[model samples]
Target: MKKNDIIITYGTHISKMVRMVLDKAELALSIPKNARIGIKPNLVVAKTHDSGATTSPLMVEALIQYLQEHGFYDIIILEGSWIGDDTKRAFSISGIEKVAEKYKVPLLDTKDDTYCKIQAGPIEMEISKTALDLDFIITMPVLKGHCQTKITGALKNFKGCLSDKEKRHFHTLGLHRPIAYLNTVLHPGFILMDGLCGDLDFEEGGNPVPMNRIVAGLDPVLIDSYVASAMGYEPDEIDYIKMAAELGVGSMDLEHANLMVLEKDTCPVKTIRSRKVQALAKAVTEKNACSACYANLIQALARLEERGLLSYYKKHPVCIGQTFRDQSGNSLGIGSCTCRFIHSVPGCPPATADILKGLLTGLNTK
Candidate 1:
């Protein structure tokens, strides 16, 4: 909306989408015709675009061509995939090298960048040193579902800028929400979201859904809001969106902004979950169970509290195992009936009975 909120475009032709997005924005980015530009993309997993997993290289190269035409050169195609998959290998396998060769741009595997630690929000993170010296960083991220945060957009793409070792810690800090908090401080200069193909659930893990759409914007929150809309969910479903909004990141409610729906596009996409569900949300192994269960438990507790049935746990902090060190009262564990990880009604997570008991255990229901 307005001159800057978010630009939505449709098409597989990379150049056409870039031009359409910028045209819709109605503003020109005044970079030199021969300035140094870096094309940073979501090369996570190094999978092809059809997999709905990674950023499409065609889109990244498209930005390069657009920059070149507008008087830019000395460009570098940068990405840091993961541990086992080399960025160089992913670049070659995904045909990023071909695009780089065609454009004579350097292919940079950012894992080699000198590291710098920066503290923000509740966590301290390590980032690439190249960030300080870059003339401009053009971000291209695949719009997809994430098990932890719901959807990954411009902000999540910042994970690519960190070394693989640091990424492990990102998971440690509570996955999705922590990552969003981390990105708010490390702002990228420009962001062009690649939605040509995206996983409807779990950004990097879920099966790809064919949603041929792209959203571009300078505001990471705006881009995230668009991706949330595309996934058929509300912005509040994502914790970071709420946190970012509270942190004065940007508006999640884009309907109030300068939203210009293309005449060629549908009014809005149907909720993806309404269709055949492709994947189930599961917690990553790295997170302690407490941080993972805190939100849900809090919600359940609130409901119980409203019903005047939440007093048992006052004697002790309900410890859900590793999430915290020890509990002061009667601690109960829960496990899903269907999971092999479950031994019985009470296992590890926080069982329904335990919850009900907790709700009524200390309350004067009489």
Candidate 2:
């Protein structure tokens, strides 16, 4: 299969799907037996894959089994959870540690590992040593929407390899160009997107939209572009994906890329779930809001509407993001970005439950 070739195998049997893709790609012949392979999965939170916040451990187990069957034993699973979350806890909660133990594959927490400075253009970031040492890298990212970047797929999953300090610094710098630069420098041998159940609008995952399928590809940018189209977005809609394409990481031109299906997909690609997110975001007075903060607010409102407590939300816009700084009025704000507002939900990215309660309290006080 060409680098631009994307293969989609639809089924609940994840291991079978994984093996099928590898066989079709002829991955074993391409790499040496003694090569040090690193399997990177998105484990941003201490949550199960069913929650859509992390990669499926079943998928990892299948990949490990596939490698071991092909005389490849030098495999290690590495990841760092998002700031404020524990990587070890994420591994345990996501059942990745158990998978690692079963396969006798060591697990490395990038959070504790020393980092080396990597610079691409003006973007300088610290990446974990294990990430840099691997002979081959396989990324398993949960396909989902990101509040800041619009989408998180192959390229964005590498953010987990950064040190906690660098992760925060990436936010301080614009996320788009840095993400592009990161992918430009660090290359992944293959990408396996966990699309069985993923959050429609949140990278951290709360409302999972089930679409049982495994998407395997060699090109990260092409995979991300296809995911963009599948999720009701143009490739250009996401700045980072476009930027990555521009930086020569890979092609986003899906029209030219060969998308093959190993079998007929019983589950057709759909975008109806994201429309609800668009509708919910309409009530948000947002400007430069971070992904986690915006996602929290949306999920909180969703919970309220579901529980019939949405009536408690006053008929006014709920403001959020850095653009709301020093802004005043009766507007209910969220996160530290809206600290200037008297009526605000606290935290850099406040908990979804806390956001719901804060909004309810604000309404009652009014």
CA displacement after TM-score superposition, residue 88 of candidate 2 (Å): 0.4
lDDT of 1 by residue, 180-264 (tens): 6766666656777877667655555345554556677777877787666555456687787777777776777767656544423
Which residues of candidate 1, in runs, are more than 4 Å off? 1-4, 26-35, 263-366
- Candidate 2 per-residue lDDT, tens place, 94-158, comes to 99999999999999999999999988778788999899999999899987778788678999999
What RMSD does model 1 have? 14.2
> Judged by TM-score, which candidate is best?
2
| lDDT value, residue 343 of candidate 2 | 84
Q: lDDT for each of the candidates?
A: 0.61, 0.80
How many steric overlaps are in each model, in order?
Answer: 13, 0
CA RMSD for every model?
14.2, 13.5
